[model samples]
Target: MQNLEEAELCFPQLLNISCKKHIRPQAEAMFIYIVLSSISLLTVALNLLVIISISHFRQLHTPTNLFILSLAVSDFLVGLLVMPFQILLTEPCWLLGDLVCALYYLLNFITLCASVFNMVLISVDRYVAICDPLHYPTKITAKRVQVCVFLCWGYSVFYSVMFLYDNLKQPGKYNSCYGECVINIIGPADLVLGFIIPISAITILYVRVFVVAVSQARAMRSHIISVTMKHSSTVTAKKSELKAARTLGIVVAVFLMCYCPYYCVSLSLVIGSSTEALMIFVAFFNSCLNPVIYALFYPWFRKSVKLIVTLEILQPHSCEANIL
Candidate 1:
């Protein structure tokens, strides 16, 4: 009887311990889901607003602005369609069934690759225009820009198809946490080809771009001083060029601030395990930061926002005037 009583007491203790262990993981998962969902929603809304403002304003439709719009579109889709699903199904498993999981992963890969490729194209465009102004129009013609954009999408689709094929063939072979869609082991090859290579190329291109821009700025400054006593025409042209360069600089700065840490964290994940969660968080934060940075730092975007607000305010007034 004494032995039976001891066993009964111990059984309750064991059950309690087991419950606590399971509850902790559940709570942690819940916390992560809530935080990630909030971030995703905020990012999606911001990007959507930017896209709408740019699309509605005819004046904001330059080639550079078009590229930014494409980026904003990609970010918006990812935040709205991908991140929420990921946060909600945090069991490290693909809970949305196989077909949906495959599609989601494929879209994720394509958008991410497209984002990186677009950044490279933007950097190259800036470099050519700033460093070789005489040939800018000829070298970066509208047709050439269209070709570049098409090629970016083509490469993104190709890579995504290949990745999807491999993932589908294996199903859950390389997945972690049983039936999950995550890469069980993020190899060095994956890191290099997927992120590091493109990031390095972008960094080199931007470095050259910076050097050319600085030289151009210095030359413009000297010209302004040399022509200080002359007519204002040359000074006005130089000032316009300076303003354009300043705008480009802001764009590059925001791009670097948003992506540099993300790539660094991703590359580090290839070498260490201590930073897995932190790196994931940093990468996720990149999508959210881009729209905010644009709104805060880009005058063109700010002007668009003002125009949108003004139009909204005027619509009712115009309607009332007509009614009157």
Candidate 2:
């Protein structure tokens, strides 16, 4: 009986002060480790490819790609810094000390916030580009994008600090026992600030962009001559519709799909539970999905990946290669 009890304790030496080991099956734990580790590695690798693709290929540089690069940087950090720590959480106990746990949560807050904000920025960028194409060049310049990216990150840090203020002040205050790492997040505020605002902004902006795009498509078709031009005009009109649909599908649909459940779970105010972990992981999976979508939507990304994998970028003045 004593042996069994000791086995259940996270820190056997602590006796009464120790947290109990998580009561998951060995096989299940291994399965989770394998899956999450694979995701972490894939996230890191894919986001790294995006970072290299944008930074190395000179012609690929643009205001839009700059937002993507900022996103890749945040996603890259999520895979590198946050995911591994999260995986560690699936273990028997939190071996890392209290301050590390607090820091980990802080980093997680920053990255997730940065990702959502970056998406908003991307949505606004597209809105301007599509709805006001005439002013796009003058309005959404590279320098302006750089400033937005900087502010996005800065706000992420500020938001994180405000969100986790109490816990940051007293790391591990909510831990039930010595070997546990738990945090108490400020409520309603997380749901409102993190979920409602950003999601609403993205949805509204994308809806406007879609409306404009469809109208433009109709206008183009109306002006199209009805001769040999008919077939080509129809093709162009269809492409416009397809592009608008795709933007909605990828940006809004995927974002809602990934984030909704997590926020729904958060609404219940259940933090630091197995169910919460599952829901949060679903949200983090968005980082992994981002690069996949990029590869699908951006031809330059595919071309740049080819050049990068071939190591052709090592050649002299390879940045000048016109992948666009």
Candidate 3:
């Protein structure tokens, strides 16, 4: 009985060759399951709302929103495909075998990379709109945004495949025992490509955005008493830009907070420990966090959700309805 408890083979029939179960307390496992499951469901539901809202509403069909739509689609996939597999990974046994595990991590990487790319696109959109408003409309057309989205997804697939090439070539290559699943990351490469480059782009762009926004806000304040301020085209444009920068800045800030820890850890060393699982999941949890931020800050998202939930969108000409 003591040996059985101590060994706790993931596959008892295999005995010596089976992996030992790394079982937590039953209560702790149960809580983790419930939390992760809830996150999965919420992530799916909220991202679907964003997708439907943007796709079905004509008013929401702008360049900035195109980036958001792309992000929603990626988050939707994370919920639909990645999160469930992640939940299974938490289990003591690898019931589905090595190929599925490889697929799970692949899907995970693709969605996350796509999301980061979308964010970069969004920041660029905002940057152009605020910093270079005259050329913004011409520069950020729907076709261009669509092409960028496609490229982002394509790059994500290529990157993920290359990153996990060995594991894809030989499933179970890293497993020391049957019923165990493990994959190691090349920390230095991950830190450079995944963490440093993308994060640097996002940070630099947002910093420029912040500087412009703050300067514009001060200009508005200084001219507040002038009646002409309201009618000034420059003033009006600056106000709009400031508001947009503020909203999207909140989103980018939250993204940094959620993504930082995992990549920060990746910078120092390898990530095959038990604690790495928690860090990865924490980063994955950002998939759900974004839509909640949208719901809180975006009146259009709130209105669209109401319209969708109440089935008002089924009415003919509903897409023509004003969402903004």
Scored against the true structure, residue 214 in model 2 reaches a CA lDDT of 77
Global Cα RMSD, each model: 7.0, 3.0, 2.0
Instruction: Give the alpha carbon lDDT tens digit for every residue of 3-58 in model 2.
Output: 99999998989899998886788899889999999999999999999999999988
lDDT of 1 by residue, 1-324 (tens): 755443433233443221111123777877877888899999898888789766666565556667677778778877888677656444433445555666777777787778777877777777676677667768877677777888888998887777567666665555433334453323556567767787688778767867876777777767765665566775565455445555655655655665566567666554323355445445556667777777765676666566556776246433222100
Worst 10 residues of 1 by lDDT: 15-24
At residue 22, what lDDT does model 2 achieve? 65
Which ranges of candidate 1 are over 4 A from the true structure? Answer: 1-30, 92-94, 175-179, 184-186, 228-274, 309-324
lDDT of 2 at 204: 93
- Could you say which candidate leads in TM-score? 3
**TM-score for every candidate vs. truth?**
0.75, 0.92, 0.94
lDDT of 1: 0.64
Candidate 3, poorest ten consecutive residues by summed lDDT: 265-274
Q: On a 0 to 100 scale, what is the lDDT of residue 137 in model 3?
A: 84
Q: Stretches of candidate 2 above 4 Å error?
A: 226-249
RMSD of 2: 3.0
48: Cα error in model 1, Å: 1.5
